[model samples]
Target: MTEPMTADQARAVVYDAYTTGLPQAAAAKLLTGRATPAWVAHEYAALRRRGVSSMAGQQTLFDTEAAE
Candidate 1:
């Protein structure tokens, strides 16, 4: 059997899927092997709660102005 994915791995998958406009359920089924849409949604919520930024490292106008 395939090994379980770590939290970071799952987060990366979810993030990539989201950025690419792929459906969460489809991403779970195709990439995670065992994860469900609910789980992916939960992970995504947690990532947001933790303030994880986008892969592109984009900053908001507020952030840019604050830095200056």
Candidate 2:
């Protein structure tokens, strides 16, 4: 079995997928082991609420493992 991912890794994957305009379904497949697309969408919405729409914003949002 694959090792469980850290929250930081999950966040980064979600952030990158969203920023790159990946379809939610595609992201769901890509992240099946980590999170569902609905959950990814939820995180996307949260990031938008925080004004995190740019690459820099994504990095800042997920750069630190300590934050989670």
Candidate 3:
């Protein structure tokens, strides 16, 4: 059986999935053999709560810079 993924691994999956607009289920399937979409979704929420910016959020970067 595959070992469970670590928090860091989970974070990477969440980041990639979130930034690329992929579903949490896709992230789980791509990253961890044993991870679930629900778990990845939870990680994604946790990342947002921690103030990690997603690509969607970064869309404003160019606008903000142009305003300067």
Ranking by lDDT: 2, 3, 1
Residue 1 miss distance in model 1 (angstroms): 5.3
- Using lDDT, give the best candidate's number: 2
Q: Rate the local accuracy (lDDT) of all candidates.
A: 0.66, 0.76, 0.71
lDDT of 1 by residue, 1-68 (tens): 77887767877778776555565676677655557778887876776687765443334434577688
Model 3, span 1-68: residue lDDT tens: 66777878777767867776666677777865557677887887887798766666346545676687
For each candidate, how many residue pairs have backbone atoms clashing (under 3 Å)? 0, 0, 0
* lDDT over C-alpha atoms for residue 49 of model 2: 91
Clashing pairs in 2: none
Estimated TM-score per prediction? 0.51, 0.65, 0.52
Clashes of 2: 0
- Across 10-57, the per-residue lDDT of candidate 2 in tens digits comes to 888877877766666776787886887778788888877998664654
